[model samples]
Target: MTHYFSWLKNPDNRLKLLILAFVITLFPFVAVSFFAFPTTDDYCHTLAVKEMGYWGYQVHYWKTWSGRYIGTLISATQPLAYDSYLGYKLAPIVLILLYVHASLKFAGAITGDKLAKWQTYLLAFLLVFVLIAELPVVSGYFYWYTGYYYTVADIGTLYLLAYLFRNYSKLSSRNIVVLALGIILLVGMNEYTLVWLVVLSGALFFFGSVVTRKLQVKYLVLSAVALVFGVLSVTAPGNAARAESGLYPTPLKYNLLFSIKNSLAWQIHNFAKIAPALCVLALVLIPIACQLFKNKGDFKFLRAHPALSILVFVGCLYLSYFPSYWSIAEPPNLRGQCVITFWTLIGWTYNVFVLTFWALEKGYMKPVEPGKPVAWVVGLYFFFLFTGNFNYRSAWSDLLTGRAARFNKEMHERTALVLNTREEQVYVPKLKNVPYTILIVNDETDPAWASVEVNNGCAEWFFKKKFFYK
Candidate 1:
């Protein structure tokens, strides 16, 4: 074991091993994607876009449902819009690849060429793996076309952040245009990410001006662009229409207070649920973070005002939650929660890295050397993650138990049945095996359930006949 650990210490060898592990970890998710089927909102969005031209669909959604201009455009162009089931199956695979690519770019940019390529890849892989494995709702973000706009917006945000971090010292005209376009598109994508961009851009401006004592005009410009788009998105007539349809109808003051309270509560709840896994992740990250810190310059702002840094981290969490609560007087839905989980994981890891560097700089703790124990910890973490994590386990289970294939067959059969049936209302057999990782919400015998009703309506619109489960 000592010899094995020593061999693994070679950077090239480690990189190869990590790559192998990533492929192994990713295979089940990708394999199962081929068997995944759209449900609920996926059908609804596809049917709407099919009925309306792309531009008309966008305008209709803006007037009645959402002001997410970019999101509406994305939904309108989903693979189902063209009746391409192959494209639907491939969407998750494309998204997962893009997500990892964005993560690598962001990780490399933030590290500023200080760490070796292997170290950067390791960091990116860990972040991507953890976020994917522990999502609050895997199908919502990964398999469902309706919710993928959030993922695309997140990828765009990462690329934008990478550009800013890589070019912080100077900004050319081209950079300014790119920044403006990125901010507009991101803020227009969805309210959840719009609020995130607002908070992040505001922080950049504030920290550059006051904390770091260096005023970066780029941050100010970015903030201004984000705010302008934010206003356009928030003030859309559809926003009020949607709000009125929300289950909770509180006054503005009460809503604000409740949002704040719920924000705190939800983050705490999420943290508590994932605390054990976080500890293991922290262990795996400590040695890597220590090495990254060695070549990177001091964390001057974080070191000088640690309390403020911590406060800002917590504040960002609150702001992320506020949009959901304010919009509906409730916590974010599963899809929104998945984005929150991603941000929280990234933010928490950054805090840990910063704190570790601070402790070492202050001589408050000894530097943790990487060796046999680190290798064992990493191996164990991956082992348990594959075996225990809900997403991975569920993916493997769906594939191994034939649930994924069965679900696909049933859905295709339903499609065929709908196409052939001439009756005003088509009754299809209920799904016998629902794949947990592929289908977010399945239909029921009764079409009166809210989600089922939406699905049935979409089917009716698409096939020109009502749908029901026998």
Candidate 2:
């Protein structure tokens, strides 16, 4: 028993964690494997990719910009969305792996080589849990283009932070180019995080005031660039168009009340839904807290910058959400909520770590190392709890095996219609499992534009017929 527990903390545990993270990340993709079908925004974005190239995107900005503002970086998604369905379908899973890579680097920065091999592996596993455990089933946030864009961008934000922290100590040319592209993407990729970016960067301006060592010209330039991009994102013509088309625009007072209500409501819902995972989180984090050094002396750095830290802490708490308040009173769609869900997890987790570190610095509690038997039990308990409550086995099976069968059947029928019909028209049933836009103008002979249908271009895209308009 002693041998088993000791082995858990040794060199081989990192290999175990690597396998574990791969499985956790693969679970969602395998679960939603059937849902790669293009939907409303994905189709539109795919078609709109042709409008403006590397030279000009604003020419058709008013068109595709209505749903998502990919900004100039819209050019990058070309060949992927237009050339083949497989590339677009697999992009999210690829991006997710990149996010995990970036997050691991960020964690390494925070721990600063203090973590043991097992601890690092456990941290990676938990980070994956934090990201995927609470995600809504068949969520477009994972599979669809628009939602996936924001998902990867926020993770990209973590990469940017890691770069900043490390680069200040040692500059790199490659890092500069990456930061430049990342900042530009944030301008259009995610407006929700953009708002928070501006808020947090402003806080950093004051934070630098106290930390003389941080008052570098490069830091100032980076902050300025972030602020400028953030402003451009908010003032975007597309953003104004979305607001102008609000379903229920309430008065300022009512909107504030709504934000307050939703802020708590969603927070409670997320915590309650992931209650078992939270328990596992406590179990894992307690052990880590024990290992982290216990300092008896006060943190004079925090004392000198109390207000700055408080502002940053508070900004992390609310800034990701404050942008929603300015929008309509109605609840945002599932895809839209991904931003809040992710950032809320980040903000809440960060504050908890800050408080934990502070207590460790002040020596709040002695380390709690379980006996071998107890430690083995903790591992089993966490795995059992996580799988039982959070994995959603039925949903995964239904979507991957069940819905995939349906998609295959539908495609077969769709091809049959195209071949049999001479009028260049066919009736493809609207799907229940997925949202598919109808092809408003599929007829090639009739050049005159027809009435735009709801399920626009679905048949043409499915069959790869390339009719007059998709």
Candidate 3:
């Protein structure tokens, strides 16, 4: 344990560890993309966007924009939603690429090393693992393209924190102001993300002193400015109205152990059928032990560094209390307390505990040759986490172009039908330009779609009443 603690102090080794951390982060998304879209959330959000196209927003932006805006302006200006599903699909890719680039840079900052060509390959593999851990959720989101924005928001916060940490020493007045501005922008874009962003930011301020004893007054001022700006942005009338348009005032639980258990269980259940061996090793048994025994800090470190303890405590508290939200107000609830806990704890165990300790205990205290076997061992460890899984590959391909196009085509035809239009357009909430537009269009192609029928009164009659359009 002493050896490991000693190893963490070495800046060079810390760089390698940072590279290792990124691999852990990226691999899960890559692996899961092969199985399913991240979640139906992406499609659902797209539906909202489609609704925006078909009708104007009801309460929040009622006077500002309507569905006509979507058809006329948005489609023309942004490639995100255009004439076809392909355009909609490619829209989120740009944000995701930005996220990936930001994350890579962030990882490099923490590791304090340039990612070599070989390291970059490993980085890709690691992304696969990160995506896998996320599993079906990532692929499910990939289908509609919009879901990626939610994820990008989440990951973007982490990258921003990494940026702050990496540039902790060299933060100038300009840099601090820019970071403050960035936080403000992020808050306006996504409130839930801002909540986690603040939590992470607080964690950095706490853990930072542990790594670097240099605490500058400027850093404190900058953080304060950022927090204030973030609050203002989030509280902006427009942003708040948007948030209220969705559900709110949900409670959050901070029970770490329980949340971790729940997260592990869900991941296992989601992936066990697809990748049993990997699931058993990574999600089920190994992580259990890793969380249970290995993460415990020794007396010297734990006792001496009361600040670290407090940071962990406060972070856990914030994480527990934070309400889980999605991109849309009526967004599908994926905010499992346990899932968040597992992700948080894993980062703790890997980056904060394992990698940090390994660096300190080994020759990290003194500069060692770059060819250390430990680096190789770390590389292999991440490789296994990323590769050796194949479920999501099929799932992703199925969603990308096929499903969206099919739905749009069917919807177009159904809306074209008089019976469909009368049934769907009746008594439904009207949008701006596309008032009384058909809500759902179905056909004989699938019994499911065929079973849905509507009448002149907009009364949706499902086959055997199995489903309701409303």
Off by over 4 Å in 1: 1-3, 212-215, 246-256, 298-305, 360-366, 442-456
**For this target, which candidate reaches the highest TM-score against the unseen true structure?**
1
Distance from true location, Cα of 95 in model 3, Å: 3.9
lDDT of 2 by residue, 89-190 (tens): 466567667767877776555444467655665566676665665655334555555456567667777777666555544556666566656776665676
TM-score of 1: 0.91
Say which prediction, candidate 1 or candidate 2, comes out ahead on lDDT. 1
Candidate 1 local lDDT, 303-339, one digit each (tens): 4345555777788777777777777777788888887
Task: Order the numbered candidates by TM-score, best leading.
Answer: 1, 2, 3
Poorest stretch of ten by lDDT in candidate 2: 433-442
Q: What is the C-alpha lDDT of each candidate?
A: 0.77, 0.54, 0.40
Estimate, for each residue in 362-431, the C-alpha lDDT of model 3 and write its tens digit. Answer: 5353323333455455556545644443423333333443543344444444334424443333222221
Error of 1 at 401 (Å): 1.8
Candidate 2 Cα RMSD (Å): 6.4
Worst 10 residues of 3 by lDDT: 431-440
* Global Cα RMSD, each model: 2.9, 6.4, 11.7
